[model samples]
Target: MAELRLMKGNEAIAEAAIRCGCDGYFGYPITPQSEVLETLMARMPWDETGMVVLQAESELAAINMVYGGAGCGKKVMTSSSSPGISLKQEGITYIAGAELPCLVVNVVRGGPGLGTIQPAQSDYFQAVKGGGHGDYKLIVLAPASVQEMYDFVDLGFELAFKYRNPAMILSDGVIGQMMEKVQLGDYKPRLTNEEIIKRYGSWATTGKTADRKRNIITSLDLDAGSQEKFNIKLQNKYKEIQDKEVRFEKIACDDAEYLLVAYGSSSRVCQKAIDIARGKGIKVGLLRPITLFPYPSKAIQELLPQLKGILSVEMSAGQMVEDVRLAVNGKVNVEHFGRMGGVIPTPNEVVEALEEKFIKA
Candidate 1:
């Protein structure tokens, strides 16, 4: 049976990882996200489900550990905050280059460097626009509530392996530390080595046998032409993801004259803003993008006919707003409103920005 408990968002992520049969978790501690490591340590899934949990020496080590595990077709993941995630970018790119499936959870904080340990969505470009090198994309999921934080862990794994690429749960300190009631799923047994071999033998680094040649995992090519072909293949996969996997939610959009675009915790705030706007006879709605990379550009374009303008509300220095502008493509007025350095914008503030940008302007 499923269990219901009041768990912090970070704790819910850990609980969901264990319950979803994660083979291993390798992570280092960072504020707002440290509970993920702490909760996993307290739960000790190794004893219950034979899951392997380790406190890596650094974020670099943690991400490389994920690479090593995923190469062997294991369900692996890691968690960190801003600066820590920056340290792991090289390994993250290596994993992407190698086309390994894994999960990376970034409980984002403010920064271009170690800015603050508070909640912020300033990592939008890093998470969605490829912080690493070469050409690659991670399947990015933005969870707006605690329940979603719990749910997206398994969903992240599912998409990672399905696409044979990395996936990220891009959250912030607000969701990470906040406590909410979560319905935890039943425990799922970790996959045995034999099951892994059986499932991914064709591509994974399973053992060599007389009947089959050994599988090699790498992202290197001595020939430039060969590397170009490989890059093309990756681009094709990304195109497919864009087509089939764009996820979003539309609230009160049918009769809306203006739209507010936001994600994660900011979207939650915008919900309240929508109510306040509607109460004042303003027909405003929200378009919350759940998948950041496979963004809801089309959804924004679809609502263009009814909207007089669009405002993107976020906790950053206007990152996602660029994408919103591209999607609108000069068809309507688009603007950005945000707060940085860990300050969250309030509902009224959002409305004020909306009115100021679209109404008063």
Candidate 2:
């Protein structure tokens, strides 16, 4: 039987990680997401499931710890807010270059610099466009609700291991702090050392056996030619993910004349806006991207013919609008509507923007 509970999104993430057989968690506390580490510490999964949960001195140290654990074929994760996430980028790039599997959760707060502790979707570009210095991408999942907060932890780990790349749950302060009902999934046991060796010994840094060669996990190749080859390999993997991993949800798109493209908390606001627009007979719909990295570009492109315009709604100053425009390719008018620095726009405000930008225009 599934366990049903009312919990905050950040707490759900922590509980889900333990239930999903996560091997370890290393993170430093940050606003809007501190509950993740707190919950983990409170539960002490280390005593129950033998999962290693540690709070590092800084976000930098935490991400590096995740990198070290992931190299050993263990399911590891870390969590942070915008500024803290910035500190993890270097380690994230290294983890990607090493082709190690791990999960990262960023409960976004307002930013540019320590801007605010409130919710915002300002980090879309950083999450999807590789914030770190490298030719790499993390499989980014944006969860809009507390239910999804629980669901994506398991899915994120699955995708991470499948691609041997990092997977991130890009959430925001609203979802992190808001309490909601969640139906927890069945518990999955952590894989044993022998199981890890059997499944990932080819690349993971498991101890060498006489029957096989030693495995190495690294992101360095001094040879230019070899480095280029590695880059090409990473590019190919990204392409494969783009083809196979795009996820999205469409609401009232079939008969809509205008579209709204959004994700995370903005998507929830857009949903309400959709209702408002429909009530006013505006025929507006929403397309919510679930996977931000392998974005639903193809889906957006296919919906272009039926739509007269698109409004890329966000909680940032129009970051994702660029991607929507790139996908639309000027087939129709596309505009952006947003409120920045932790201020969330109301449904009426989004509807007004849609009216001004698409309906009235």
Candidate 3:
């Protein structure tokens, strides 16, 4: 049986990390997400689980710590808000280059520079489109509720290790701070160091052994042909992940005339708007993204033939609207409806936007 408890999204993430047998956590505090660090500090997973949790001097230092731990072939993580996460981009790129598995959480907040501490999905592009330098992708998971916050941490680690890549739980202010009843599941660590090396030692830097020569883990392929080959392999991996890992929720989309595309906190509002639109006899539905990086493009394409148009409701100006456009492929129109800063639009506002943008047409 699953145990039920009221938990904040941030607290659930900390607990999930312990359950997943994460070896280390390094992070610097930032608004709308400091509670994650606070919960870990109070719970002290280090005492019982032998996990190392460090409050680094800055987000940059925190991510570099993840880099170091990942280099050791250990399961590790770091987290922060938008500004702090921005600082960690260089380290993120390096981690991807090394093909080291790790988890990163960006409890997103609005921003071009020092954006508000309020919840926002403005970082959608940054998370999915590679905020760092280079052609790399992170396995970005967008959690719409506190329950998802707990659930996706373990899944994130699994995906990261499986691909020798990084995964992110892209959350927002509402999910992080809001308290809700969450079903706590298993906490056993899935992979051990010996097991990890056995499974991934083809490239991981375990110590040189008698049976074989020294091994090096690096992203550098000086030979152009080798680099291109390496890129092709990565592309194929991304394709495989798209097929197997993309996750999303569809509410009445089968017959929906006007679809609301949302994730994170915005999805909550859209949920209410869907109900309200239904009450008014408007055939509205929702497409909530659970894995933002994978983008749920296939699902969108599947429903494209049925949709009149998609109204992308987000906390940002319109970060995710572009993805909706790509998925719809001009078979149907896509328009964005959102509020910037910290102000969450009311259900009425969202419903009205849907009516004007999609239903009226």
**What lDDT is reached at residue 191 by model 3?**
62
**What is the C-alpha lDDT profile of model 1 across 93-158, one tens digit per residue?**
999999999999999998878899989999999999999988889999999989999999999999
Among all windows of 10 consecutive residues in model 3, the one with the lowest summed lDDT is 187-196
Expressed as tens digits, the lDDT of each residue in 1-361 for candidate 3 is: 9989999999999988888798899989898889888999898988878899999999999999998888878889998999999999999988887888999999888787997988888888889998898788999998888999999999998899888889999998889989999999876854667886787666667787787677676678789998888878877887888888899999878778878999888888999998999999988889998888778998888887777778999888898999999888888888999998877889999999988876666
- In candidate 2, list every pair of residues with a backbone clash: none
Candidate 2 lDDT, tens digit per residue, 199-224? 99888888888989898889999999
Best-to-worst order by lDDT is 2, 1, 3
Badly placed stretches (over 4 Å) of model 2 are none
Which stretches of candidate 1 lie above 4 Å from their native place?
Answer: none
Ranking of models by TM-score = 2, 1, 3
